[model samples]
Target: MVPEANPRVGQLTTQWQRGKDKIAAALISLVLIVGVVAQAGFAWQVHLNGEEIGVVKDKASLVALIEARTHEVEADKGYEVGLASQVEFRKIVSFSSDDAEAVKETLSEGLEFGLKATAIIVNGTEVAALATLEEAEGLLEQLKSRFIKTSSNLEVEAVRFREDVELEETYCRVEDIVDKDAALNVLLHGSEKLLQHTVARGESLWTIAFKYQLGVSSLKAANPNIKPEVLPIGSKLSLKLDEPFVRVEVVEKQTYNKSIPFATTYTTDSSLWTWDSKVKVAGKAGAQQVTARIVSVNGKEEKRDILSTQITASPTTQVVARGTKTAPSLSTGTFLWPTTGVITSPYGMRWGAMHSGVDIGAPKGTAIKAADSGMVTFSGWNGGYGYMVKIDHGNGTSTLYAHSSKLLVSQSSVVEKGQVIALVGSTGNSYGAHLHFEVHLNGKQVNPLNYFR
Candidate 1:
């Protein structure tokens, strides 16, 4: 009835319709897949006391949530908790979010019980921690009482444990709770064990303490029965650790008696002859009672205070008489020994030659003196005489000192009687240290012993 449609046009129309159908089917399939994927499961997140603990997908009941969280918390913290006790649950709905780790961590924190621990501290450092404040304080008191005596005369100024203490809220395990005796032992002696030291020869308590890095008082306190001054050889010494956790300090006042030695005094008498002395009175030691306050730490004295002293018996003072008489000088027709020695050679003729002086053996550097007050005429090296000093007495008398180590006076110097003028030596014509001394009377050599006494 119409013009026959072209075969190519018909084919093109068919292809266009098929492509449109394919695109429609693809859009429908994508919509269905998106709808299925959007559907998600939801659960209630349980929390204790306003804190989120865990989510519940199967059981939405609060009781079931509490039981589950309790068991989980107990297993996580290694401790059990009372069911629904001190616990409040809060539910927060969440979808497609797995918070198992956060829930466990929150439940662990919520189930923990805050514990307060008191610490025994020494020198601002914590030494031990106790369960309760009363226990810690009691331990400190017990340690202080170890050094306190029960005697009526025992006066305690202050008793204290040498450490800083504090109480704080912290987490602790059930096993860490300490008992009374255990706490006391740890508070006093610390965790370190007793170190044994064998006493060696020439080892004293002080040396032992120094070697072990302990106080001498602490060393003595460890062995109360042994004396510190007299230590037995090969004895065992219980040396503890240095700087003990607790130091028991005590102050006491005591009275003791001791002897006071008397002193000697001398009285000079000008009329008494020289080399004469007499004891007028004898001295005797007296007794004194002293009251002192002593402060000791760990049984060792740290400080001492002398309260008062009373003399029980009066001391007898010693009295001695000393002579003050003046000796005669050279101007009084006398001479003194120039030096101290035994005369080895006398002034005489020997070996067919006249020996004009006396030779006295003395040590080198011995002081040589002027026999009498005179003026020095010669002081220098002499032929075969070594260092010599000659003095003119200004009364037709002169003296000579030879063989000296050194000359101390210059020529023309006035010297007093018995004044040091030279030192002994063996300089020339000599084999040893000696002094050849001569006394000349009006140019004639004479025996020096006749002038010296």
Candidate 2:
């Protein structure tokens, strides 16, 4: 200060002070930047319908991962799928970055997919969902064909479902889509589960089989120890019924040759007993070609119509002479009609099996009359005949009345022609209310229709 202030000294001092301040300001800025980097970071938080799933550092990377997951699902399921949940990316400042795999896995767990599928609708109720329409249609076709019985004499006119079956386009959950086979099984079975049946009053093997659309043979096979001739009340029977959910109506035209039955007439002969008769002319069956239109449901015949009948030959009528002098209480050489009804089943080769008796369809409890006067040989429950009555007429002749609801006479009791002996019923292995009538000549079964007048 003494002599004059040195200008260089002053300038150096000023420069030092300015440099110190600059360094301090730089340090402050650096501290501020470090604080910002530590406290906050740019990241993407995944939100599904306002529910946070996960976080990722790079939005584009997360998006790529989600896309990959979608493709993976689509490839595995063999169907196109889309995200069903609401997805949103929120800008967030996270302390640390999240791994791509973790973010994707979390999002995948939270998100749901919508599948494009076809639902099989039966009567407005959805039964099964298939991946494609073609698969649905194929399944329906398979159901229709399941009941078709192919035969050379049949011409399939039409095949359809009884219900309003349709394939509807729909969007379902990813889990709703099923394999073709599974869907088919659902349509085929569909909650119609009837695994067993309990016998009730007036129920027979034929009735049970008809109710479940099962064959009598099949029903017997399912319950090996069951007796079709006697269905005891409250007894359980195993059922093997697998009818489709919707009924399949198969309309077909069948053409085949049928045998025309011969008629038997009588002539008056006062010399013999009323129950005795001698065949003057043997019966010979005529031939006819028949064309019929049949409608079937679930392989069971529902309706049949005879389209045309070409008589190949005229039937030969049998003649028999009976005595008028025989007492009414004893078996005269003549016979009378047992019950008034249509002959349902005839005695002959039926369904490639021998049918030993004629079936007469009548209402239950209808009076069953004796064909001729004879002594009661049997009057009790038979294995297949159910409630039965048998009468023995002299001269190597006997008659049986089967499937009766009640027996009015006992064994060893004598009955005359036109006497009420039993009541009609559908017991045992029978189908409906009917009488199974049989006649034997010389220890051999004969056609009862041929002997009835």
Local distance difference test scores for all models:
0.75, 0.85
RMSD (Cα, Å) for all candidates, in order, is 21.7, 16.8
C-alpha lDDT of residue 33 in model 2: 77
The reply for model 2, stretches above 4 Å from the true place, is 1-40, 58-65, 97-104, 192-245, 265-282, 318-453
lDDT of 1 by residue, 294-394 (tens): 88788778989999999998788899888665333235367888888889888898788888999999999999988888777688999889999988786
Where is model 1 more than 4 Å wrong at Cα?
A: 1-88, 92-97, 105-113, 116-130, 140-251, 258-264, 269-284, 292-313, 331-453
Candidate 1: residue 398 lDDT (0-100): 84
Local accuracy of candidate 2 as per-residue lDDT tens digits, 211-254: 98889998998888988998899999988766566888999999
Per-candidate TM vs. native? 0.34, 0.49
Best by lDDT: 2
